[model samples]
Target: MFHKEGHKIIIITFLLVVAVALGAEYLIPIPWLQVCIQIPALILLILILQFFRNPKRHTPHNDDHIIAPVDGKVVVIEEVYEKEYFKDKRIQVSIFMSPVNVHVTRYPLGGEVVYSKYHPGKYLVAWHPKSSEDNERTTVVVKNKVWGEVLYKQIAGAMARRIVNYAKPGAQATQGADSGFIKFGSRVDLLLPLNTKIKVNLHQQVKGGIDVIAEK
Candidate 1:
């Protein structure tokens, strides 16, 4: 199914595609050229629809497991100094989402949102080492009895200009539930305790709200 956040854009795109096809059919005298132009427009609409699709996922209700926040390939898994919320060393797990991947972001686990902040910055490539710190991003920290405080960030890539975040301080975050959405391409960084057991490795493909990325 398509995501609710994309309903307006999808409808607009659909109407634009239909208008273009009709214009080509009536305005273009050459039938072959009209077909060629309409075909590309139709393909573009299909691609956009596919990008915003929010497939239903049944997340296992395990408090110890941390579900992936977005559908993408794991790019980084290492210990890094989490300078934002924790201000200490933590294990960092990063997933890189391309234009074709679903742009929806989900909460990794259920908890009380302790911190939520947005930082506007440069639009660097999502995979770049500095992208997590330099790119436009939103930082969200969720605290639970099982996992303490887990920090996750949505970093905008070169293609993404808007980052929508639903997290706010003192709000309850449900595990594997929709937390936000990023337009086009982006990356998500999860900062967990250094001793947390990682379930996935670098380069592994993950599905948001489906794949378990780590465990306490």
Candidate 2:
């Protein structure tokens, strides 16, 4: 199986260290320097193990009306002024992702992409209030028959910079289908209709491509 590049980072680091260890004997042939190299090599190996650890999966069994766009803890869930696209009051649910969380984004509902935009901004912390507005983000609006129109955004955080969005203005998107990917840490915001029922709460952990966030 092909591992995601994020998963392979640790493996590549380990191999590089091993190669350096073997090359030291031929190049330097110094006993004192070998001990120095060995100590740091052990430390790096431990860090690689931690970086490669898989987060617990939390996929929901059903997808009736809504699903999670990304995996992480819900940081904000309340009625707020959504100034980005609608410029009106809407229910905003924000999920904060740590470095360990899967950064891939999925469509929350099956529909045709109505609009899509990518913004360039600052790398604020994912949980910060300004992060959603100030951080680099990609906005996708999907038109669903049952849900009407829904908008979801992928925002980059301090450790994350690249936001990969695949859906175009007229693309077809299925519920739980891959829409894009964010590197490292980030956040996602789901802007829902005022009457849509929110199923998750603050600090509640949710899984991308699963974990329904709302329903008709």
Candidate 3:
């Protein structure tokens, strides 16, 4: 299935591809030239379609388990001081998303959104050490009786131009539900309690709403 955020772009891309194919079919004198033009046009449309594809995920709901919020590889797992909200030492787990990875952000666990804020900043590479703080991002904290507050940040990568966030303070968040989308590529940082047990390792590939990244 396609994501709602991609509907407009998908339609525009489909029309553009059709126009390009038609122009090549009739205007190009050589078959090889037409093939070259049409093939790339189709490929462009395919890439856009694939980028926004939102496959349904059946999230195994467990309040104690914190699942991966996006489809990507685990790039960072370390204890760091999160200054924006908690302002204390926490285990920060960061997942880096490439151009081809699913860009939909999901709630790691069900809870009430205690804090949600957007920051407009530089578009550094997602993996850069300072990207989480220097790049365009959004910080959201979900609080529940079982897990307390779990904070996650969506950091925009160099290729990303927009970060869509659906989280609002005081709103209810469902575990594994779509929380937002980051166009092109980015990364997500999950800041948990210092004693939280991380289940994933560096370079490990994970799926949004599917893979557990940590637990109490």
* C-alpha lDDT values of all predictions: 0.95, 0.80, 0.95
lDDT of 2 by residue, 1-216 (tens): 211544566678778888777777567778789868866886887655553344444444343577888889999988888776788888999988887666778888888999999999999888899888888999989887787788889999998868889889999987777788787789999998899898998889988777878887
Give the clashing residue pairs of candidate 1, or none.
Answer: none
Give the Å shift of residue 199 in candidate 2: 0.6
- lDDT at residue 106 of model 1 (Cα atoms): 96
Per-model TM-score on C-alpha atoms? 0.98, 0.80, 0.98
Structure candidate 2, residue pairs in collision: none
Superposed by TM-score, candidate 2 places the C-alpha of residue 88 at a distance from the truth, in angstroms, of 1.4
Runs in model 3 deviating more than 4 A are none
- Quick one: RMSD of model 2? 3.7
Clashes of 3: 0
Cα lDDT tens digits, model 3, 1-216, are 999999999999999999999999999999999999999999999999899999999998999999999999999999998899988999999999998998999999999999999999999999999999999999999999888999999999999999999999999999999999999999999999988888999999999999999988
TM-score of 1: 0.98
Query: In lDDT terms, how accurate is model 1?
Result: 0.95
- Model 1 stretches with alpha carbons more than 4 Å out: none
Rank order (by lDDT, best first) = 3, 1, 2
